[model samples]
Target: AVRIVNKRGQFMQEAVPVGEGSMAAILGLDSDKIVEICRSVEAESGEAVQAVNFNCPGQVVIAGAVNPVNKAIEALKAAGAKRAVLLPVSAPFHSTLMQPAADRLAEVLAPIEIKDITIPVVANVTAQEVTSGEEIKKLLVKQAAMPVLWETSVRNMVAGGVDTFVEVGPGKVLTGFTKKIAKGMTALNVEDAESLEKTLAALGK
Candidate 1:
């Protein structure tokens, strides 16, 4: 499943045009197939659209100009996609369409002081652990316009002996992804008081 983090309000405040862009979830298709479908649409309509998120094995998200995005969705559905639904978003994030936003974000981050992280943080763009503050800052800027490598990041964590995952957030999305990425791995989430108690009990604490 593809989960979208809506930042349209902030995007509009940052000067991204309204209604000119959109995002859609392409299910039941691998990355290569999704890319192929996007390419076909681009060739036919000459509009920019591409796969932006590799969320899991069989799910991906595409973003770009609204026309092209909708075109790709229709093509994907015709090409045998299980589902292709337009997401409620204001901007085409994580796609080349966001290059302007990414550039502005870089300027916004330039003045901020970033301290070195004590623990390894998997970067969204490279799907690798980044330590240096400088590298982290650069990656953060690039990540705004680059596809999120979430699946690869999870694989790296599993390879590094992370068999148990605790998602501390408002949703259980990551916990769900964890189960799909690594079968039999303990996956728990703490989103509220009740969930926190359940997680604590699961951890025998």
Candidate 2:
């Protein structure tokens, strides 16, 4: 439940490089289909495009070079995709294009000591819980260019008896995705003072 915002770090700083990347959200398309779309676009355009985020069922985000991303959007739309919209982001995060950033991040993290976790931390790269500090450090580096297995992580949590999700961030994006991921689950968010009060009221706290 760690939120990294307005933070200065090698990973965050390197993930965003100027003018060489773009991202887009592809809705109403299965993960496999989106992967296919990305592959096709990359092959045709000779540029990189990869599925970066599995937000929920039928909702994935792709990232790569700007031209190829645009190409994929057009191709996806032509292939009967319900929506393919460009995201307002500076870099093609979680794609192979970010490998350089990941490499730099690994160096930066090498000296930082990671403490053993008391609770299970689900990794974005593996969609599984990791407890070893070393493993966590490695995964954090890899996650820069690796697809975020958010859907799998959520499903795993649900299967493990998690029925309610509270998003503590600046936006309700994750809350919306949670609802789409599990219809029977409860999703709530607290992004501001008002939202905090509302969440507290809902929780009867």
Candidate 3:
């Protein structure tokens, strides 16, 4: 899955020339407020930007053409955002600018065989539990051009009785987000051999 997404990202980069597109994180602002500011900026600047990630309450990510994104950042700060910072990404991802890439990815995904999942997967596109393979494939394509409902997905999992979140791989960033998104939830990270051992010990394995 990672391989396919990385491959398709090449096409996404081509859709927007380097430095022409950008993304930013708006902290201490509501998503609705962020969206409204972005739209107003888009209308005035004749460029496009939108709120693309509802990371958690009071935090959202926006992405689009660089000019619009910069405009939106200023607008959001003026509207009471605590901070708005540009992200270190070459292209604006999960925005309408990625539609061309998503279309091409659909073609590449069409021939692949996808088996149904045994464990329910929370879809980033929908923030809902998905079990069927076909739905998963379709969502993957849509995710390229749609906002991520990360906050909603985490809330849904907690409400459904999930109490522990173990983030494996390079960073503990998601674990930090999990802690902020849900109080009293156990968040763990396994980024190295020591951390893996600690995680196992904590889980009583």
Candidate 4:
């Protein structure tokens, strides 16, 4: 529903640690519940892992904590994952471990040139629409440490008259997120050729 053009350098790469930890869509559950589950698993596995992606109303994506994401890795193994291991992104992203990264990002942004935003861009930091490029940059740095406010962002998009949510790029992940956050709002993706055709056809209607 939101489109923030990657300022020259930002890029969306495939998520590393693809099948390492077990990430289940724990529906009918809140973020606190998911954090508890991650804690439970971490207690059993002696690893530092916690909920990473707070995507929607009832879903929470668990990632590494501290001890290790070994317990989740084991669960994935039992679920037929061919390979599983810890991720290699310095600190466990989205966790408190990234506080240092956030600090580093802040330092990096302090001297970077910032321009005004020409279009509406949804901010993951505040889950609000940000029109000032400087604010957008600041938000991006803060997002390195703060939790992603995807649900609120999606809600804002719907409230702002964006009836159709089109996720452009690979994967139906965002599309699924739109469904979870705004149940009545329809979501479509352009991940593959078939999906693109279907999306185009739907748009024509």
Best lDDT goes to which candidate?
Answer: 3
Candidate order, lDDT descending: 3, 2, 1, 4
Give the alpha carbon lDDT tens digit for every residue of 1-205 in model 3: 7878787988788878998999999999888889898889888988879899888888899999988898888888889999998999988889988999899899889999789999999997999999999998999889988999989999999999999999998999889888999989999999999999999999999
lDDT of 1 by residue, 1-205 (tens): 0111134225433544878888998989778989998988878888779898888887889998899999899888888899987899878878877777677767766787788989999897998998989998898778888898888988998998888889998998878877888889999999999999999999999
Q: Predictions ranked by TM-score, top down?
A: 3, 2, 1, 4
- Cα lDDT tens digits, model 4, 1-205, are 0223332112211222333323333344556755665677778766557766678876555555433565654554454444443444434555545556556566666777678877888887677888887887788777765667788889998889888899999888888888978888779899888998999998994
Minimum summed lDDT over a 10-residue window in model 1 is located at 1-10
Query: In lDDT terms, how accurate is model 2?
Result: 0.84
TM-scores for all candidates: the values are 0.89, 0.89, 0.95, 0.64
Query: Which residue segments of model 1 deviate by more than 4 Å?
Result: 1-15
Error of 1 at 130 (Å): 0.8
Cα error, residue 8 of model 4, in Å, equals: 13
Model 4 poorest ten-residue lDDT run: 7-16
Residues 136-170 of candidate 2: C-alpha lDDT, one tens digit per residue: 88998888888999889888888888888899989
Report the C-alpha displacement of residue 114, candidate 3, in angstroms.
Answer: 0.8
Whichever of 2 and 4 has more lDDT, that candidate is: 2
Steric clashes per prediction: 0, 0, 0, 9
- Give me the runs in candidate 4 sitting further than 4 Å from their true place: 1-27, 32-50, 68-91, 192-194
The global C-alpha lDDT for each of the candidates, from Candidate 1 onward, is 0.83, 0.84, 0.90, 0.64
